[model samples]
Target: MARKRGLGRDDVVTAGLAVLDHAGIDAVSLAAVAERLDVRPPSLYAHVDGLAGLKRDLAHTTTVEFGEVLRDSVLGRSGPDAVRSFADAYRRWATGFPGRYEMTLLPIAADDDERRAGARLALGAVQAVIRGFGIDETSAIQAGRSLRSALDGFSRLENADNMGRGDHDADFAFLIDLLIDGISQAGTQPPGPA
Candidate 1:
């Protein structure tokens, strides 16, 4: 077998993601990634802190990639259009990389810059969509949370093959429509007596 001497941090992360894609997140371990790379687990310590650090790095990578896909999805779009685009793109990203998507949900420590950057990028897209509705920051935050929760929930169910025989596309579109209508209605309402 050829030597794995030049393997770097990225190589480890890439191997980890491949392991995830093939065997799900639970199967991703330092040993598994090292095995995929034909190297000993201890060799990975040069690139990653260990299993936990590998997971965090995977989360950071997937989140950043997801955010970029989201940002691109909403380009030149706003309001309901942007919302729909965002939802569609989000579903695409999540479903395409369900294992990696799960990684993005891993907890990030306070000082984790990569995780923070990835999260901020994803949130910025949502914030932009909310602002397009003329929603204030306080309300936008709530809206963002609601939108994310809905999207994530649906995607998780679908990724798990648990949509229960429903017409998945129709159900997703219906949810997206409901979300858009709610945001639009909220935008048209006056602030509660301040």
Candidate 2:
């Protein structure tokens, strides 16, 4: 196999993301990425450790991006409006990049500082949404977890075409509205980090 010029770690990762997005995780391999980059499969090792290392990098990159997207979606908004925007953005990102979104479910080892940092950003965004409901520190963590659970379940169901015969958009809207109403009834305290 001939060496491909201008190949780099980012190039390999970009190719991996493209292939993963286009053909799903099962199609993402060193050979596929190298083929996308017009390089030999062995050439990828010069940039990434191997397939596992490449996947780790992909996970880290996508997690950070996911956090940023969620955080940005609610910027300049507050309360129920913020919750709506954040929830909608969550679904959009998940559906848009289903393969990368799946990476969020995998373990990010405690010692992996970069991945941990990314996870923190994501957690912070979720916590902020729950806090927007005026949930205090005492309830933010639980509320955040609950919110994530709801979103994850619906997203997975929708992606798999298992959301029954109902209108998904209406069901999602109702779910968000239910959450807003419940949180609103819980008492409106000032928003703060848990």
Candidate 3:
């Protein structure tokens, strides 16, 4: 097949993301991407190394995309109100883009600068919200993990179609309430052993 006249790496990544969002991660093969781009699989090699490389790139971009979702979700917001916005945004994005959201869970290697930065960008956004409750820097990491654990667990359950599906909004509101209450209490407590 003739190489597309103006194909580029970003085009490939965008095509991969489309395939992922439409099908799933497993469907983002080089052939699939190339077919979508109207190019041959080998044509992707000029832009991406291969399937593995393409997936790595996809993960990086997806992570950054999610971070942007988070940052935008809480812009000009603060405190528990920010937490509610953060959770709502998180759930909406995670459930809305199951395939891409899964990419955010991929492990970022030490040398994966782009991927690591993307993760930091995403997590740091949430951490910033966690810190809004007036928790100390040292304690915020633990608190952030706890809050993320709750959000991740709930989103995963909802994605799996296994949740009771009864009032996810109210359920998320209740989760945020528990989180806000706990964070408020934690901020007031003296440092204690984990």
Quote model 3's TM-score: 0.94
Model 3: ten consecutive residues of lowest lDDT:
185-194
In model 3, the runs with Cα more than 4 Å from the true position are none
Model 1: runs farther than 4 Å from truth? 192-194
TM-score of 2: 0.91
Question: What lDDT does each candidate get?
Answer: 0.88, 0.83, 0.87
Judging by lDDT against the true structure, name the best candidate.
Answer: 1
TM-score of each candidate structure, all chains considered together: 0.93, 0.91, 0.94
lDDT of 3: 0.87
Residue range 1-194, candidate 2, lDDT tens digits: 67777878898889999997988778889999988888789878989989999989988888888988988887778788988998999999998888888877778877778988888877877777777666566666666777788889989988788878968899999999987886776555555455
Cα lDDT tens digits, model 3, 84-190, are 88989998999999999988898887789998888877787788788788887656777788888999999999888878848888888898899988888888888
Clashing pairs in 1: none
Residues 1-194 of candidate 1 have per-residue lDDT tens digits of: 35687889999999999998888899999989988999889999999999988988888888899889888888899989999999999999899989988988888889898789988888889988888999755667778888999999999999988889868999999999999988877776765322
Relative to the unseen true structure, what is the C-alpha lDDT of residue 46 in candidate 1, on a scale of 0 to 100?
A: 93
Taking the candidates one at a time, how many backbone clashes does each contain? 0, 0, 0
